[model samples]
Target: MVVVGHIFWLSDFGRFAVFGFYILSGYLMTYIMHTSYGYSSLGRKKFATNRFLRLYPAFWAAILCSIVITLFWGSSSNGFILPTNLAAIIGNTTMIFPHWMPSQIEPRLSPATWALTVELFFYVAIALGISKTLKRTYIWISLSVVFIVLSYVMNLYWHARYFSIPAGSLPFSLGALIFFLSKQKSVRYIPEAILASPIKLFFTSFCIAIVTSIAISQSLSFWLMEIIFYFCMAINFLLVLSLAKQNTFVNGLSTKLDKKIGDFSYPFYLLHYQAAAIASVISLGKVASLKENFSLISCMLTFLILFIMSLCVIKLIDKPVEKLRQTIKAK
Candidate 1:
């Protein structure tokens, strides 16, 4: 959905997909920290180290890939800088490029990495609160709500992109809460009928309809669509919760596919904007000019090529990094 929505600009699937990703991250990270790693100082250090290993190598590879694509196929004005623009590249290397650089020059390489920056901050927050999370989950959940409210207000009034931190805090909090609640022996009231295939199908179809409505409203310039979008997004939280509980036929299929597709997902997400940029140049001779929103064939072709390249990266780069992380963990 993210890939297609982005390349074609047809729907707000990218936005929806990102929200889902954030929520899932929150759940998985909280689970790992609480269950796998202890809340002591050494545990926190190991947690932080593991997260760094997971994030940085893939991110740097994506940055390099984006730069190479931009240099070969992108125009200078397309917000990507070459090796000659050392400072811009340096800022990106630090992953704080958006913080210090001007708004125009920010996200010059691997534009999607803004999410990674927000995610890194979340990791720090989780690490700092590991002890508190061990003792009292409620306090962390409260703070998460406060952050979400503040982020929402800032997003409404402020133009800065980093203001997303607070908004993202809410979903992350929800994920943590979901994990905390799911483990409780007393909270076992989930109806088996709801988890049945038919009900799951209904919920999935409803969510799809909501996404389609959001896209239609956005395209038609409806003021109420934002309200609807937010409402539907909130509903999506429940959808995720319900789906997580049940292992359906579809879920089983997805699980099998994720083994192959999951590794490519990160690199694909990181490099896709640049892939689109490359596709534009290949098909239209200009990065900014989109032929009819975007040329479907061109974007798909570019995405396929990027996917193959990402496979090479996963094997050559990500696999070794994973091994190195395992070595560190063993130490």
Candidate 2:
């Protein structure tokens, strides 16, 4: 979904996918912290280290790709000499950037990485308070609501209404609620079909979400502001919870496939723009968006390069990091 959106601009799937990804991240991180890394000081230390190991190598590789692309086959309108620009570069290199930093000042080499910036903040929050999560879950949800409300009231951009830290944390909080939900034997209103066919339900909601996003973006209808965000978010929560709770052969197989694909997703996401840029530079004479010169052949080649580079990064970086992460899990 993210690849298609970024590489082709076919829909708002990339933006919406981040909303869903945060839920998955929050749920998975909460579970692992609960089960494997207890909130002891040593446990927190190990968790932090493991997260750094998981995120940085692939991020750095992507950053390097961005820098090289800028230096050689691309243009850098933002000069490297300004102190602010250099600071942004340093921040990007370290995978540390202030969430409040304006988009123009801290230019994301790949725009998708803005999510990672927001995500990093949450990682620290998780380490510090994942144990208290059930107790403070509503607080997180409330903050998300506040953020979304503020964004809408302020007439901020579409991304701001949903995926900024406060608004974005809604999905994460909702995702974490699944952890609480699974604990209660009495909370049993879930349909068997949803649990049995999580992907089907998810895709149906996902399509609705994409269309709703377009409606919201274009202001095709006014009711979207009041309704669509919550609807899409609730649907994602149910889908993720269904995936988490179900134990059947079909879901088991899907889980295996998810795990396999998830291993590639991070590097693949980070490399998507670079792949498209290279493809565009070849076929269209310069780096450009989907709006520039829509070419099926270029998009196809971008996917090919993106997939190949994603595989290479996994083989070179993520696979090794996984071994180290497993050692932490073993403890």
Candidate 3:
């Protein structure tokens, strides 16, 4: 993921990965909610309670730290302290600021909180019974495509600039569809040879599309690029699911890493931007520009330090708040 971020700095293809993340988030969330704890089991109060516990404590701690940093370091050209207005503060604390306000006012702490805004919106939408209403597999798949197109249109017109939906939303929706499909008893499977062949073909085609898209267009139309991205992500997910079902070596490797990385992934992603920003400021982007042996050394050192700091924050601040939230929810 860090490599992708660095690539994003270098070329446009790197930007597509962000969309991949969003889509994956949507899919995983839907899959977990539906398969593990049936859609009906996740009522609004319970969903909200669980989500709040999972997200808010760490998020608020990060906000508080950002505030302290802003006070002492002062706002940089890109940085702004939290708005003093009660409305703005409340909106931000609740992760509703982006929905309620425009993008002119800078975010108080991490600028990347804007994505969190979209994520929060998604969570709220789910909790409000959007996911539960999908009684058929086709409905979920169709809605995913519809939303992806809608998100693309929103991007094209810039009407809803603040609610930046990541490209990953489509695949995530597809993931939900996959979960729904898996539960159906009459879907019927293809012959083993056919299934294997199509999965392979899908993967090859998906990779070719991604590489071709990157090679040909530096600034492709937003909608066009998103369509290609959705195709690639969907194929990728399908391939993974096939492998998992077949109990292949690749599936075993992926399952092991997915379990470990998935555990740390959220915290790692949440804290990485802040850590990177802090490192960039301190190093003045010197590490970003190194070459040859020094470049590798600098990059490793920077990543290590950032990871350690983030892990510390996760353990000390995030974990405690999580425990507190769990306690409250139990009560």
Candidate 4:
């Protein structure tokens, strides 16, 4: 959805998508650490190693792909910029290009990847046991609220990089809170309808909001959209918790599909921007503008290419890394 927003000039749903990613990351990381590894020194080392293996190999692959695609067929269009030189290639591979390099020189191979920088920082912080200070649910909740408030204020008055730090941090903290809350006895056994109905409504309203805002981009203000987005995300977080334990959807079919979806998600996200750019170049000629050339057919072509590419990377690259991690764990 975030990639779709970037490609199609839809409402600012990308912000919520990134925030949701942070929250999910926080919950999963915390759960894995608490249960699988605990807080031992050796455990932290293993955790950090597993994290790197899980993320970096695929990222390096994406960087290489972006470079090749951008070098031959890249055009700056609809706010998408491609890497052009060795410096960008190096910086993007490091995953710190947007943060460390000067904005003018910083090539946005995939501008959406700036969030990954923030996520990497959080991963390091968690591995170093910075989460020790946030044990109590109240503390986690309070910090989450503070971060969200700070993000909102920063976004109102500050530039992109400045707001991004807090914006990224906010959902991560919320994820920790959700994890803690899930451990409570009272969180169990909600009526299924309480969750299922809202989730259904959320998807419906979210689609309506995105389409309506894009249709009337002139009438929609940023602040108004922000309000709607946050409301949707809050409802989503609630749904995340409600459905955390109840995974069997008609005897495990949904769970298997969900895992497959998860396997493809990160690679798809990393590759989609460049894939869209490549699609534009293919359909509209090398030099054509993205806005002029973009159509339903181009979008479908991009999706097909991205899906196939992501599937291949997951099977060929990501799965081997996973196997290596499991082998190490077994040892």
- The C-alpha lDDT values of all candidates are 0.64, 0.72, 0.54, 0.66
Say which candidate scores most in TM-score: 2
User: Cα lDDT of model 4 overall?
Assistant: 0.66
The estimated TM-scores of all candidates read 0.80, 0.87, 0.70, 0.84
Question: What's the alpha carbon RMSD for model 2?
Answer: 3.1
lDDT winner: 2
The stretch of ten residues in a row with the least summed lDDT in candidate 3 is 285-294
Tens digits of per-residue lDDT for model 2, 153-198: 8888765655456655777777777877767654577766566667
lDDT of 3 by residue, 1-331 (tens): 4333431233344344444555555655666455443445434455567677787767776677667656755654334465778877876676565543333445546545666666776665555445554474356557666755775566555323223443334555555555554454433563445335444745564465657456546766755654565566655555544433442533336766755555565556555545544555465642222222234544565577556866776678667767776665454
Candidate rank order under TM-score: 2, 4, 1, 3
lDDT of 1 by residue, 220-321 (tens): 443355455455555555555555555353544676586677778887887776666766776777676342545567867777777776887789888988
lDDT, residue 148, candidate 3 = 52
3 or 4, greater by lDDT: 4
What are the candidates' C-alpha RMSDs? 4.0, 3.1, 5.3, 3.6
Better of 2 and 3 by TM-score: 2
Pairs in steric clash, model 3: 19-168, 23-168, 27-172
Q: Is candidate 1 or candidate 3 better by TM-score?
A: 1
